[model samples]
Target chain A: MASAPAGTLYRGGEGMWSWVAHRITGVAVFFFLLVHVMDTALVRVSPAAYDAVIATYKTPIVNLMEVGLVGAVLYHALNGIRIVLVDFWEPGPRHQKAMLRGILVVWLLLMIPGAYFMMIHTIEYLFGSTS
Target chain B: MSLEIADPRSPGAVPSGRARNRGNFEKYSWIFMRVSGLVLVFLVLGHLLIMNVLDGGVQRINFGFVAGRWSSPFWQTWDLLQLWLAMLHGANGMRTVINDYAEKPSTNFRLRMLLYVVTVFIIALGTLVIFTFDPNLA
Candidate 1:
């Protein structure tokens, strides 16, 4: 069969977008892991030095960033599962579009509680709940 | 001159066997990404819960807290496996990205070389840190 013209389903639709999103999130998470390992490695320097560096992570700004990180990781993980199903399941291709919608719904559902739990400490601190 | 036809089944006429039996690196790399990704979904999400959402989150995590956790063989093993798996997984993912986007063959080789260097360095550093962490270091 001849290929569909450029703007068809496989070319510029859900499949493409999911592919783009996966690559973007994967790259972001990969770079973050590099920095995270380096930061964790600070323990070998000195406890004080390590604690001093980790202190930055506790700040409200970075706390919010952690929520974003969680979002990226969660999306990547869920989408990754979708990819696996597409590769290994017989009916996966037929249902991939529907699966993307399902993945997004699940991602949002998890992110709401995830972001809240991750940020609750920062929220409390900002409001003077703790010293 | 009469033309002679070579037999396809002759040893010299056939291609080398090694060509057909070359390694399955790409196939294994593809399989590795999927397998490791599935494992990481559990390991990383669990890690996030414990480190970022459970008690006080990052506020309570310091050197001592790290020491306390690494004191256990279980946690040490958990972290060591996590470091290696996540780093290798990320490296492979980045290599794919570079392969897809780099316009020139030379650029691809250079970028992947850089990626390998950093990936190996980070993995080695993380492994050493996890292995050599001293609880009593004040």
Candidate 2:
């Protein structure tokens, strides 16, 4: 029985993938948070020190990275809610697959506008703005 | 022949129940994740909206902007709370991750110690920055 073929237990699917994604995104975001807190702490040193470092964050490459960071945060946040629902809500486990769909849909809806807003400065800086 | 039924809720199966019976620390950490996660969904999202999406986005952030924001007690409190909660939540999450993946007991202990050290350092630094911020320093 130990070495038998897979059974009814969930092996790999939407639920499993989401769980993997959650761990990856969580670790990534956690590391970013560490660096961010360090950078923000530079404000205590001197304005020159803080501004000099922050200027790099405004560069085109880093700005693009910011969008990626936002995307990761959004996914983690949405999927986190779904996880909470599955744990707390009575019907959540039964409908977890559907919740995954809802999370993806909402994530897309938010990311579209979010990415646009976050990238506006980068876009303008790269290709000269009309206004 | 006797029947051998498999227990779905075995000690190894339910991490939460296992933690609960062991001690209060792990169980509280589990509850902390859910509560802090829910609060962070709003706090972090709002922070990203204001800092990364509003106005000129990242380009407009600098010492002056940070100074202005921290000048308000409300933003200061918001940031302080964010720093503490996010740090603790992330630390606990990382602890669980290390426990799961580290095959060697020694490696797990060392990694978790490092995580705790980093977590404490960052939280202290962030809190100090927020509290001791001087608008006129610039």
CA displacement after TM-score superposition, residue B41 of candidate 2 (Å): 0.6
Candidate that would win on DockQ? 1
Candidate 2 structure quality by residue, lDDT tens digits, B8-96: 67845545544446767777888999999999999998999999998878889999999999989999999999999999999999999
Error of 2 at A79 (Å): 0.6
lDDT of 1 by residue, B1-138 (tens): 999676667746654665456689889999999999999999998999899988877889999999999989999988888889899999999999998899797898899999999999999999999988887876
Q: Give the CAPRI class of candidate 2.
A: medium
Q: Compute DockQ for each candidate against the true complex.
A: 0.79, 0.71
What is the Å distance of residue B132 in model 2 from its true position?
Answer: 0.5
Query: i-RMS values of the candidates, in order?
Result: 0.8, 0.9
What are the models' TM-scores?
0.88, 0.88
Cα RMSD to the true fold for all candidates? 5.6, 5.6
